[model samples]
Target: MRQLIVTEFMSLDGVIDSPGGGDHPHAGWTFKDIEMDEAAYEIKGREQEEAGALLIGRVSYDEFAPVWPKMEEFAEYNAMPKYVVSTTLTDPQWHNTTVLRSLDEVAALKRGDGAPLLVHGSANLAQNLAAAGLVDRYHLLIFPILLGGGKRLFAPQDAEKQKLKLVEHATYGNGVQMAVYDVVR
Candidate 1:
């Protein structure tokens, strides 16, 4: 079975909102504010290679479609398959991209034998996948600060529960903590 890994750059308090700038009120708190070393980049590169495909929420898709594809350095990701979960997007401009309207479609994709399908920067989609019990693993890169108020990975929905077992962890030179866990049922 193909694993579905939800990866995100979050704050200490679990805020995964827009970290770029202006797009989210709690923006610019992730890694942009500080300097990172070569180790973090190398680690991230490894994570990118472990996934066969990318799964992104509509918002993240929109944010990335115009940027990552144009960057020459991210050639591998630009060429890799991308699946965007969106309700209204009819046409996806990114090469090797497809739009999925429902969460059930993700389950079918995971049934195939392949490298893990990675979901990045999609808090809402991650929560839905969590609620549906579809996410197999979670790889979070948690930064040091807490953004008091911002988007959260887990939503407030009448006490939902998830059983997660820590599989691996590492601390980068930039004070970024990486945690990988498998979801247990």
Candidate 2:
């Protein structure tokens, strides 16, 4: 089975929304709260390079499409295949991206034998995948700050409890915590 990895930028308080920029109340939490050193940025770039493909939710797809394609730093990302999990988006503006219809379709694609799928900054999609037991692993970059009343990774109404085995945890010099976990069932 192909492994599904969900990657997200989260705050210590579990806020995973608007890590870059958005109209949300926590729009600039990541911008104002944390700082990334050259080493840390390089590590993040390396992580993005290792992924075979990127899976994104609609909002994330829209947000990233305009920026990543124009970014020279993300040339690798532009070259790799990108699958967007969206029911509403009929067309995607980004190059090298395709749209998947449903959760079952996503599961089918994952099981059909291909390289690992990396879900980046798509919290809603991540929650759905987590609830459906589709996510095999998680790569989280947890920053040190509390952004109260921001979007959450897994909402409280989601009663599912996912057991995860912590495989690795590394603290960067700039106070960013990186953790890798495999789903334990």
* Candidate 1: C-alpha lDDT: 0.83
lDDT over C-alpha atoms for residue 44 of model 2: 63
Error of 2 at 120 (Å): 1.1
Q: After superposition, how far is residue 181 of candidate 1 from its true place, in Å?
A: 0.9
Candidate 1 ranges beyond 4 A from true positions: none
Best by TM-score: 1
TM-score of 1: 0.93
TM-score per candidate, chains pooled: 0.93, 0.92
Tens-digit lDDT track of model 2 for 1-185:
78899887889988898888986676776667677556545546766777788899998998999889889988888999999999998878788889998999899878967667889888789888888889999888888888876777777595488788999888888798888899998
Which pairs clash inside model 1? none
Residue-level lDDT tens digits of model 1 in 60-173: 988888889878877877888899999999999999999988988888888889998999888889988888888989888888887878788875676378889999898887
Model 2 worst lDDT run, 10 consecutive residues: 35-44
